[model samples]
Target chain A: MVESKHSWKAWLYLAPAIVLLLVFTVWPIINTVRMAFLDDYSGLEEVGGTVFNFGVGNFIKVVQYQRFLDCLKTTSILCIATVPISTILALLIAVALNSIKVLQKFLQTVFFLPYVTNSIAIGMVFAAMFNIVGSFLGTENELVVTAGVINNVIEFFGGTHVNWINVGSTYAANIFVMVVYIVWNALPFKILILLGGLQSINKQYYDAAKVDGTSKGRILRKITVPLLSPMLAYVVITGFIGGFKEYTSIIGIFGETMGPADASGRLNTMVGFIYDALASNKQGRASAAALILFGIILVVTLINLQVSKKKVHY
Target chain B: MADNNIVVMHERQMNKVKTASKVGGVAGKVLTYLFLTIMALIILFPFYWMIISSLKTLDEYRMSVPTFWPRVVMFSNYAEAFTVGKLGRLFLNTVIVGLVSTLLSLVITVISAFAFARLEFKGKNILFAGLLATMMIPGELFTITNYGTVTSLGWKNTYTVLIVPFLVSVFYIYLLRQNFLQIPNELYLAAKVDGTSDIKYLWKVMIPLALPTLISITILKMTGAWNSYIWPRLVANDGVHSLITNGLRNAFTETTGDVNYPVQMAAVALVSAPLFIVFIFLRKYIMKGVSRSGIKG
Candidate 1:
């Protein structure tokens, strides 16, 4: 009330953004929530057929689906593995970059290169690389393994030749591929954020610690971790949230990554599962799966918010 | 006796420090090189693969033996990708969408940021908060409604469907807002004292100051728009006005019948090549753009 002078103009100035957001973002959210409760989400076909029915049907169907539960578990496991590893690695990179003054920007560029590349094309390339006898870097592979350090590991294990995209129920195998791709994709931005957190930390704090005869390890553990908690929290919450909505790189039910046995069944990623279901042409079940996914996302997001509020050291 | 014991303890601590730093240092050096090389390979591998693979004949493609540099590099794959694929139209479609969306986001973001930053308006905080809250919501949750609304409005397969929905980004708005907020309050006050209106102050002082950030945001959005996949797939009825990404996808898939792997790879390389080149220059701005989010993660 006190700041009510000429309030009308702000609305005018803000109109375009507000209007666009409503049409694009805000309104869509409202529409999704409403549609989630309805029975007829088989996408506008049979136009007069029970459009937007307000009932418990979609939820019931979603909850009852065994695939939905499997997807939730898969997505959870994927996030659990990806988040901690990526976060830890990003922190380490940030710390190292902070220590070395030379090639700092160059290193940042290198680490982030994967993130800027076309993910879909990468998916295609990964599909090729993991295809049993796929060529390493499109070169002549005269032997079972490429002439690198990892060749020894393959030899030591008496490796059975395997198609990475074939095995349908091997969670570990699928997760391994996903982890590699996700981590590579995630490294750049994660490195960038961690670098930011490192920047915000005053060098004076480190100097004070040095003068106190404190070890570098002790200084990092005491001062650095606590201070960067907010940023780390942001990373973790958004990491899971982002993963849950993932669809771009994945080939859906028909995929180069998910080979003949439909290895996508082993994926367990929530978004992947829902997307697979949707792409399978079972629109009702896909909608049900999508709704279930939405609920899982909502619950996890709530937990993230509560935990962040409690622990983020702003 | 005390001196001897003190020396012994000091040696142990120093050794521990030396060992720890050595281990961490070696690990750091190894990781730094390892990460840089592996990431570089991973980033470069797809394009490298695309180019070499595209040069190979079908016999080379389907052969039991893996040919590294292709038996003979053929440039015809590029010509063939353009001719057989009708990839040129797809390129134009993506260009139109990318340009339109970027221009719209740039204009709207500038105006919105100005209002949020300079105006002495009521409920400014509330408006900003509402906008920020939208950021936390996963985009997919709202996608269903967007698809339905556009369908209802007869906007499907039109430029409106492709361009209108992404007119303003919350992320960009926030970026611009932060930039606008940094201008000294006196600058705006002086403009007002000189009888300048809100729009003029924005057009002259704030916009000029914010142009660097704005250009960076514009380039980023253009890349995002051009690279966009799922939304366009949903909006496009078939491949009528399909972008190159979608075009390559359909070509590779069984929908269009026989797909030449070499040609498909060529198309992919063609579609993604511009961004790959542009990123060479835009790399710095991306660091600027992503630093805010990346640092915290």
Candidate 2:
């Protein structure tokens, strides 16, 4: 090894990245922690207040805010619902793609399309697709899924036509749309990763199982799942992390207001809540909310890591 | 005669098993193809809808039962989308920001990666570890305070605000450093023996060897710039400075609150065209880069 000595040249090379990190990343980390404890940093100038406070007032305020609590609930439900579903869907699709011999590359490209497109733009398409009825409250056919084809199919199949994103509608419709979007959006990268993992697994296991006349289901359960566990663990962790920050897709589907403008916008996630708080001069509360989100993510990730250590293969 | 009869009977049973398995295998293959075809249709349906909707008239788009394909094929919607939505300005702004940021970040990422991979420095391991740890923290934490910092700096609605705050990606740095590390130490030593300069070796040898990864990083970075919405929306939602994603929001909405669906779809298609093109052409790089990083991590 060329054990080069300590040199100013290395520092020169590192200075730009390091400086940017300090100003943009490192400093913000400190500022978040500092601001989270303060009561009213955004309004300090008007009140001539100090920026430092060791009290837990900001945290208390965040917890006390009804909207913040609702945002947390919304965020949790979306994450819990979307993550597993997307992961499992990705796994199944990846396995299928792996098993097939013809047009593998073609199918893979089609599936990966969503990963590259702008989420918000595609979200607009979804909004339009699910917007059956197009503001005509009463229609000739009460059973029609008005704005798009999805509802028409639902109606054609003897299912009741439900409003997908109407302000007064139940959470079921919103959740169904969000889940479909998230899973579709999430599938590409997960499938790509799992496909790579699948390819890397030793084929000898399958061959050996075949020689022993093992059933396909048994082979997949006993051999394939364990080998793909590492990738599964990766997908789940990243999915949860990405799911918690589910702001843009909502914006894509609902636009900048984050949900239907008529009602109080019931679909706000934690990040969206923080952003709203910041926008509305609730910087102290926003900081507290951000820190709390950070705490939640860290705790969840650590727990995931612990679980993966036991369950993940290699 | 009895032994020969037993052998023939056993051969017949084995042949029957082979035929049954072959039948099952063919059925399974058919099922796989059928499932893939259906899934592909469902997956690509939105894209299909986007295209046909862009060709629709406002009236057709609002039809109680939407047409699978546009009736009149109103291509004028694209013109309206281009001019009315101000997509030209958005595209120019996005391109300028994307190029400037990607170029600058490339420089920073390459140099930093080189240092970490090849150079011996005090506290390198600890610094790299710290950087990696930061990745685990959600970016929402940074946005909380970065918003204040940028606002205080008076950078609102500026190109600098769009490009600078997110330039140094630890993931890119880590990715490039891993690529650089794979180049054997012997190569560096051999170059040093010839009195080759570090910068020259990096430019001449290391970079070329790592071109695939660098290309991947560049594509990813630019795509990121194109897709970015939240930060850009938060800081630069001003009409003159907005990125395409933020600009597309309500761009075609009438004062009466009814969105011109056809025009909006046209605008989305226009905004999405470049990405689709990039995906078609450079997908291998994107997949390779992502998978490489995922596997390593």
Candidate 3:
């Protein structure tokens, strides 16, 4: 190594990223890990003075918290529903647009617009849409001013006017809307990568399939999809990881009701729960909840990496 | 006659196969268009509503029949939001945070990426892999410690809290490193022979070649900083100011009994517009970074 060219300057350039990561990322992470065990928020004990210290009580308390279990379930449910559904929708759009001759770029732009928009803005809009009265497309609200619009739609469905956010059914509805927003947000990425992978497949395969009397559906399943599995794996696992880390919409959707609320509430995500605990200054509880959420996501991500490395069909 | 019949039979079979495929293909196309239209509506409706709601007047927003489309378009909602929240200053703060952090992060990551991808050193692979694993560690796990650290340093309500903590992004480095590694090793060998040191070689050789990746990563950084709700919420969502999300949230809650929907929508639209423009050109990179980075920010 010493015989190699002067590498002294490399460290000089490396110093900034390293020092900041150490000070900001690594140190805070270490401190957070330590805080997870502590019971009280008053302050932790130190060797010479009052400092944050070790306690196992918070972890024990986290396990017993009903909201923890609820959040874990909600996150899993959200991911399970969103990942596969969104991927297929995105893939279908990609393949269709890819197959077309004109309007491809225009359609792509339309589909990809939501992801670029601020989640707050998007969420605010969705909230209004979900609002019975002021919502844009929803027919349940009193507003559409068009006498028969919302009423007819509701009557058509054998239902009455109902609030999308505050109703008893808002839990599942909330997750669904959030999934819609997230999937829309995540679609362009999935579409682009999948498109890149799609284009990479040799035209020879399709030409050969035609010669062999294989149908388009057969080609899609046996060729296009299998060939695109690696990209699919990439999207799915990342979706799983990204799904649980939500914030902007949830806060905007159900403003500050994430705690001690009934079923139709956001007492379902660790991120929401952390906000809930922190709101009331229960720092210890927040730390405990944050640690649990961290552990779940990290484990899933690690599993994803390992699984994709083994099973991705690339 | 037998040979003709055989050839005709083969042609018939092929036609059958082709026709069978065509039926499903037509149905699939119809369904695909139907689904795409629905999704397109879902995707575009909220943005459309936001824009319209921003233009809606206060009375129209609160009327008996909800103004689906504002009857009398009031452009003042945005004007009011802009002035009320000191939005120009907030925009300046946001731009400063986004651009500075992005450029700083890019510069830092570019160097580290070269080191990991090309530089041969003790524990290089271990450190790089460890960094990837660290990417899985959630930011929430670190926020408490970060808060405490920021407060103790007396950096609360200061730029340090806004900028310093986020200067290094593991995900960005990972993306850049992967792009860097794709460059042929022979180029480095060539540079070495010319007496260009590794750092200089990286600057003079790898950086120029890897321009696209850096550009994409910069866009990603910009978008991430622009839409950062939580960190700003934690650090700046209080007495003096909060960025877009905070401002919107305050606006949303301020008119509690009245809940000025138009004004809040106006604020939301205003904040979202800048990055929305950037999204048009950087669409490719933005999608790639967000979807495939595997390392979430």
Candidate 2: regions farther than 4 A off: A1-6, A43-52, A134-146, B1-20, B250-258, B293-297
Chain B TM-scores per candidate, in order, are: 0.83, 0.89, 0.87
Q: Look at candidate 3 and give me any clashing residue pairs.
A: A37-A55, A44-A51, A44-A52, A71-A268, A132-A141, A143-B66
lDDT of 3 by residue, A162-250 (tens): 43454344565567666766676778667867877887887657755865877667988888888888888878777777788766556
- Ordered list by TM-score, greatest first: 2, 3, 1
DockQ of candidate 3 relative to the true structure: 0.39
What does candidate 1's lDDT look like per residue over B1-297, in tens digits?
A: 999997687667666655656866677677766665564566455457667877888667655545668887878888998877688888888888888888877888888887787676867898789988877665555565677678889998887888888787777888888999899988877776788987788888888998878877877777776667777878884778787666766666521112356776666667667876777887877677666533111
Quick one: best DockQ, which candidate?
Answer: 2
lDDT of 2 by residue, A9-127 (tens): 78999999999999999998898777777766664453465455576799998898898888888889899998998888888888889999889999999988888788888888888
Using lDDT as the measure, name the better of candidate 1 and candidate 3: 3
* Global Cα lDDT for candidate 3: 0.70
Judged by whole-model lDDT over C-alpha atoms, candidate 2 comes out at 0.82
Per-residue error for B154 in candidate 2, Å, reads 2.4
lDDT of 1 by residue, A1-314 (tens): 22247667778878998888878887766655665566645664436565556676776876676866766766677678888888887887777777776787777776776666566655655545444332233356533322211222354578733334443324566566667667767777777787788888877577556445676678778888788888787777778776776555455222533323444354545555544544443344454556566666778878988987887777
Q: How high is the DockQ of candidate 2?
A: 0.46
| Candidate 3 positional error at B186, Å | 5.3
